[model samples]
Target: MNLRPLRPTDLARLVELNDAAYPAVPITPPEEMTALLGQADFTFGVVDETDSLLGFLIGLRPGADYASENYRYFDSRGADFLYVDRIVIDATVRGAGLGRMLYDAVFALARDEARAEIDCEVNLDPPNPQSLAFHDRLGFRRVGEQETKNGTVTVALLAALL
Candidate 1:
């Protein structure tokens, strides 16, 4: 698979992969995704030669217009951070290191921008142990946690220094 900037044409497939990730992330509609992508400071996807998106990461810099509780949660902690609004690896490609590769790209970009750290969250209420473990292996630590979606969902906020 190759990493590249995501295209508008990839939105449909992106949404499908995103929905499949479910409460691990969130089920965002294509329209909502388009809005988020527009606000994204960085975006990347892993794809095969056919250009089918196998995994992706959407990132926002400090002070983005996005209103996600998770994003705002990080802002309250501090600035000079790259907030990973969402990341989703296709079910078939979950264990292939595409997620880590995308995160490595984020770390590189953050260093280029002279950012302080990377911030993201994994489900707690929904219990995504694999995701938490993956982030842990990537040197992320649990910074905090919050309940969103009217408290139906809770997440463990994670951060890693560049």
Candidate 2:
């Protein structure tokens, strides 16, 4: 397997993987993903030896004063944090461990970037109970809850010191 920053050529595949995993997710248009890929702080994909993308993760480097903002249940009382914006794997590969691989890759990126913490949110839709458990297994603890545009309540915000 190979991991790399998202490239323009990977946008459609990336979006497709994301959509397949979370069909109800409100993704930015392909054009927007293309633009966002070039930004300095966002790190994006994971592909296998044949160059097929299995999943992708997007993270942001939160600034110093970013702590004071309300992140629901996430503990952001520290100086630095990497917020996981999204992570999705192709549904066909659901049992293949791609999700964990993608997350491990993102965590490496955060540590390399010297982020003091890592935080992410999981929507509480009925079909996504596994997400809450996954984060828990990875050592993230619930800090609080919030709502999203889809009207689904989030179970809680989760974070772990990197």
For all predicted structures, in order, the TM-scores are 0.97, 0.80
Once superposed on the true structure, which residue ranges of model 1 sit more than 4 Å away at CA? none
- Model 2, CA-based lDDT: 0.67
Rate residue 116 of model 1 by lDDT: 89
Query: Residues 104-152, candidate 2, lDDT per residue (tens digit)?
Result: 8778877898877788877665356777778888888876666654554
**Candidate 1 residue lDDT tens string, 109-158:** 99999998999999999899999999999999998899999999989989
Worst 10 residues of 2 by lDDT: 64-73
Per-residue lDDT for 138 in model 2?
86
Candidate 2 wrongly placed segments (more than 4 Å): 64-79, 150-155
TM-score of 2: 0.80
> So what's the TM-score on candidate 1?
0.97
Error of 2 at 91 (Å): 0.8
Cα lDDT for residue 82, candidate 2: 75
